[model samples]
Target chain A: MAHLTPTPVIEPLQDRTMILNMGPQHPSTHGVLRVILEIDGENVVRIMPDIGYLHTGIEKTCEAKFYQQVVPLTDRIDYLCPLTNNLCYALAVEKLLGMEIPPKAQWLRVLLNELTRINSHLVWLGTHALDIGAMTVFLYCFREREDILRIFEMVSGQRMMTSYFRIGGIALEPPLGFFEKVRDFADRFPSRVDEYENLLTGNPIWLMRTKGIARITAEDAIALGATGPTLRGSGVDLDLRRDMPYSGYENFKFKVPLGKEGDVFDRYMCRVAELRESLAIVKQALEGMPEGPIKANMPKVVLPDREKMKTEMEALIYHFKIITEGFSVPAGEVYQAVESPRGEMGYYVVSDGTAKPYRVHMRAACLANLQTLPLMCEGRLIADVVAAIGSIDIVLGEIDR
Target chain B: MALAPPITDLEKLKTHPALASLLDWNPGAIEGVKFDRDEMSIVIDRAHIRDACTLLRDHREFAFEFLSDVTCVDWYPSEPRFEVIYHLLSISKKERVRLKVRLDGSSPVVESITAVWPAANYFEREVFDLFGIRFSGHPYLRRIMMPEDWNGNPLRKDYPVEGYR
Candidate 1:
């Protein structure tokens, strides 16, 4: 009998880099993201980002509930820009139901969405700057941002994750002086952005950490499924609002800022420019405000008029049915993408002619943006890793969802 | 930044022969697939999955070039204990297609697509972390999003929410 001897192949470990385990708990990892980085002394050899520490199983939970009940759940996805998630989910369901929102509702959504973009960008700039060792920038960014959060509260009764965007239109009419407050903040925002740029743009230290750090080409950006400012930072203008033109974004005229260098600085500049652009969009939406009903005329899908709910029997029934049983969307699958501050926030919804979504999937931009961390962090200094992580602008809620 | 490609046309392409055959191919055969206007599937066979994906992705008529995401769903005692889903997008056509693979309760193994798209690497690790579904041929198969010493897949339905001992 020939002895079956299994020879263990001793492979020579050549010039391979040493493996360095980075945080699932470290504060700068941005929400339980553990990156296993291969390092060659000071330089990162390869970075592999590990996600899902904050996975909430929200998608599966959505399947168990009625359609209307899912609105509040969406507010938790990105946490920073909750209304954008609400709008995207509603748009997906609305497409299936074939309901067209009224003009006023559309304009309101555009206004709120622009405000949400600004709010989200402010948080990004604040935390991103702080991550890069600029603590003052974080505080100053939030100072101006507090005003925007107040506006969100005035409109939706919540500071963040305002489930203000509903299936057809808004949850309700705004509180008093919502426009005046928005205009006031918009007026003050231009100078604030200049302040941010001044603090970081000219400072040699800021430039050193950002200018040449984590440079990605436009080709690699698209190949890696990069979008929003991350892709735009590479000099490719791919704003879904302008190209895809959702929520009547085509009606407005605004500039899509592009960057040639495609570095952390470029991404920062892209987002800062977007802050001004978001202000411009908000101002344009207010100026071009169309006067009409806030909700669509489709009582079948949309809730009945509030006043009619008091007297009309049909209206009362619809109001009761919509909230209780939830409106039945036509059986279909539609993927709706919105230009969220982070990137392309898409909701792929499948309806089986029921009140509940057969399958609810979110193609979160933060999740995709976080994917390129390895490509960016590899070959960079250990200290620059934090700056690179901040540059990607990831939210774990979006990634884990 | 410049604008991304828009307007996906997949509804028409869902009518393709291989997938079209799937249109009426006994919707009940698959568990997670639900039909209203057409078959909206949440589960597919491990064998013909690559074919179904190619049918949706490679076909120029329904080109979904971008692999947006890969997520795992744990449904305990549902015969198929786990469901792995892949979300794809076609920038040129501007359409979205979903491919799902079912894993029975026993041994969960799904073929790795890292060779196809590099994006699947991290996502595959995530599925491994939460659901414990091993991806064969994955360059480095280890627990991602969790410590290596983690006892059980946290997202598995059978794995108690507190963690299996």
Candidate 2:
């Protein structure tokens, strides 16, 4: 509605600069992100991203729902990595409740989280390459992504919106042959990465399009609150999985890829390398899989299995009470930050020792990373904006949430 | 691990880096301190939050260079109705500390931290848009998620979950 007024979001500084409006619908933006660009001929003078087109007010909605009911809503925040959102929210609530997740559940969470990362990066690689005019990478990427989706569906019964991660632990025990399917996919995912790299990593056209385009310095990236591959691409060398380990990420061994140039290609290379590293973590999780209950033993907080609920009265009563009246959490706050595919996805949960959360705020990495767009795209060619947007890998759903 | 009780006493928490630095700089600036759930939260006096933030960011021992997030919590029907939460991270040290500034229900206003870390721009705008809390000296304080012509701040407890319509 603000844009409807006669004055622009950013006024032109010089006479030569003319205002140009990019998509709330343009394909390169990846979502309903309306960027108002002040251009001088083909060069961008200033850029301000106009968002909130996808705002669903999920945070306000979370206050009204029971704690467990909020997991399904987290899935909609960032569709690319729904489980990552699920994990972040679940961990935050669990921290508030001070519940101990079993070893098997932690390992399973790590294994599936890495798979979600690969799944997210594949879609990013495919779509990013396509945005850069490389068509084959998109096709090759979705091929592997389909396998990951199938793995998700096998475990959660839903492919995209898998609200699989519960507050105390996971929703259900991972089904039979889930590990085999994941292991089989993991065995072949590296070659698939090679296939993607061979297509774009060596292509001169791809290099010309991405390298040295929309370059940002390390200081600027950190100052602007950039995280994930965007910050790693700027050579920050900070990964929450390693620096601040959670969900048993401390047990996994993997390398954090870094980039010196902070260009589109460097960010591109960082994510691609992360694919291999994520696969390595997945393999490790598979080899050292733990054996125990998927859900926590706290029946007051966790739902009982169907068989137990039917056989035992106490179990059924606990399930009914948990369903009807949610378990209360301690009156305090905890901010849980996880290294998601995009960046540091944080969930700040505050409780009033009640069944419903008093406040639930998501510190979306994209919202902060989006601030760096002006720094990256200003003074660069207009087309470089596309490359820059792709480099950041923004999901407007997360940005506007 | 069993859940340990939170340490709310200022004397016990003054040894922490953030609280220690703030106490060293100006003891009057800190109103309260909390070490809960493995996180440290310092409730700073509203008048001195900006200076406290500057000190915390530049201090040699605890260089919390990264402003991880800025959000607000509304304790409706209470005198101090809003608590503006700032989560700061020391990237080099791998540590985090939360800074809170409470504002009365009559006038919910606090100094903007955008001057310290430019990353606070959008976050502050979102807070202003959702909770109607004003951040003084914010460059362009506009409604970010809601329409500019929207009626009320939807996040406050007084606002109905559904809508006026």
Query: Highest lDDT among the candidates is held by which one?
Result: 2
CA deviation > 4 Å runs, candidate 2: A1-11
Give the clashing pairs for model 2.
none
State the lDDT of candidate 2 residue by residue for A1-401, as single tens digits: 56455233577889989888898889999999989999999999889998888988999999999999999999999999999999999999999888999999999889889999999999999999888899999999999999999999999999999999998889888889988898899888778888898899999999999989988899988888999999999899999999999999999999999999999999999999999999999999999998888888888999999999889999999999999999998899999999999999999999999999999999999999999999999999988999999999999999998
lDDT (Cα, 0-100) at A145 in candidate 1: 80
Most TM-score-accurate candidate: 2
TM-score of 2: 0.98
lDDT tens digits by residue: candidate 1, B36-90: 3232344567865555555555665556666777776665667777778887766
Docking class of 2: medium
- Summarize candidate 1's per-residue lDDT along A1-401 as a digit string, tens digits: 22122111123233766777778788787777777777788888777676656777787678778898899999999998888899899888877776777878888998999988888888888888888888899899899889989999999888886888888888788877998998898888899999988898898989888988998887677667788899899997668888778777888889999998889999999999898888998999888899877887778777776788888999998888888888787666666788898888888776768888867878778777886777787778988888888888888888887
* Per-model TM values vs. the true structure: 0.81, 0.98
The global C-alpha lDDT for each of the candidates, from Candidate 1 onward, is 0.77, 0.92
Candidate 2 lDDT, B1-165, residue by residue in tens: 678999999987778888888988999888888899899999999999999989988999779999899999999998799999999999999999999999998999898988989999999999999999999989999988887778999999899889667
